[model samples]
Target: MKLPPIGSYISTSFIDWPGHVVAVIFTKGCNWRCPFCHNGPLALGVAEELDVGAILDDIERRAAFLDGVVVSGGEPTIHGSLPSLLRRIKGAGLAVKLDTNGSNPSAIGELLNEGLIDAVAMDIKGPWYKYERLTGKAVDVESVKRSVELLKSSSIDVEFRTTYVPHLMDEEDLRMVRRQVEPGRWVIQLVDTRLALDPALVGTASPERARVAEAFPDVPIRG
Candidate 1:
């Protein structure tokens, strides 16, 4: 089976899955160029590709201590063979979580239908109007909405995440996202503007993290 372009691997992470420890696969490339993206190299596919097989072997060796594996991005769903990659990890006795930008509903639905993913964490860019602006790409907003609807009705676990980027979005924008999706499991993250894909945003002012959290009342991913 063909493997996706694996850019980087974290052998273990406690935060990626919140309550559980898991290995992380940061895939190379993305369909959208979200300026606030922190993984500039990976998103641009400039990060050196790693041996995916070896990393899977490592995770298999350490599987006893891990609760799951998180397939992150550069938009994990963008990879056509992502299900194959997840199957290998699942074979290693690790549950899998996928992080995505909600740009591809078809991929997400396919993975769920095939029982390849145990959970999905999709990022909500902002209100629909801000999508093209934040992503710096021509976007089909309906695709993103379809992703949300798929996750919303899925039997598996899901979390709709939105980063509170002060420069790119406001509290009202976040509220609009919540109103639009009404996800039961939702989280609001504060963007660290010090580092971003767009250099102009670096060192930009951000809202108070505590205040943002208070307003959003996060549904913890942690168990």
Candidate 2:
């Protein structure tokens, strides 16, 4: 099986997933063009590339210290070989966490049903119309909607999040997102404008974190 092209790996993370020491696998390629994306190099496949073997070797060395692995992206679900990749990680005896855009629900479902991923973090990148605008793609919002429904009903631990980019987001947008997500584990992330995909987007400011959390009174907010 072809290994997913790896961009980088983090030997340890405390916040990538709550309560787990995770080894993060950064995969190359993405289908979106969110202006505020911090990992633009990964999204554009313009970063310094590394051998997948080296990444796995590093993971193997850290496996004894880590309790889990997080397969993050450049949208991980876009890669066709991710199931096999997840299987290999699970075989290492570490639990798996997948972070996705919810654009490819089937792939997420397949991994979940196959018992490969133990936790999921789906980025609900604003409302459907705004999603197409921000992502720079003709997206079927229903695919995301379906994914949300599946995650809500699935047995695995799931969290929905939105990266708060002030230039592209507002109170109304957050309201719409909250309605769609209901009362699950939701996170409102403050954008790190300094690392945005486009340099022009660097100076934009988001609402105070406390205010953003107050906007969704029923959901939990984390930094």
Candidate 3:
């Protein structure tokens, strides 16, 4: 099976996949444009093309040393060859983790049902009302809800994360997000304004972890 076109690859990363050493593959092209996105190049589909055979060969060589492979985006689910890519990775005796925006529930469902992904990290921008404002695009909030439900019911390790942009989201918005996806792991990620997609947010300060924790006493905050 032919692998999807890759935007970039990290030979080794400890933080991408929790408790595991893995190679990270960044896929090109995103469905939504978030002002706070740090990977504007990838999101805009301006990434360099990589050779799939070489990537697989490298993975095969490092399989003995690596625990898994993380497929992140530009929204990995947007690629049609993602399943094939995951299959190849699994065939190499490595596990697969996918990072998505939860905009494509059908793709996520197919991967989960087929047992192609071992873990998932889905990003929930904010409450339904703020999605369009945060993403800078029209969003299908229903699809995001469906995706959340699917992951919550799945047996795999799933985590829903929201990047807390102080200007775009407030304490009440965070609370609303927590309520919408109750009884699951929710992580609050602090935004890095240096590389924000929107120039206006270039110097915006991120919310302090302690302050966010105080605001969201029930939810977990990640720096």
Please name the candidate that would achieve the greatest lDDT relative to the true structure: 3
Model 2 ranges with Cα > 4 A deviation: none
Ranking by TM-score: 3, 1, 2
Candidate 1 clashing pairs?
Answer: none
Tens digit per residue, CA lDDT, model 2, 1-223:
7888888788789988889999899999899888888898899987777787777777877788999999998989999999888878887888999999999989877887899988999999997779887787888889989899989999899999987787988889977887888866777877888888877888888568778767667666654
Q: Model 1, 73-134: lDDT tens per residue?
A: 89888889998899898998889999999888999989999898998889889999999988
Q: What's the TM-score of each model vs. the native? A: 0.95, 0.94, 0.96
Tens digits of per-residue lDDT, candidate 3, 54-137, equal 988999999999999999978888888899999889999999999999999999999998899999999989999889999999
- In model 1, the Cα lDDT at residue 186 comes to 80
Candidate 2 at 218: error in angstroms? 4.4
Question: Top TM-score: which candidate number?
Answer: 3
**Model 3 per-residue lDDT at 151:** 99
- lDDT per prediction? 0.87, 0.85, 0.91
Q: Give the count of colliding residue pairs in each prediction.
A: 0, 0, 0
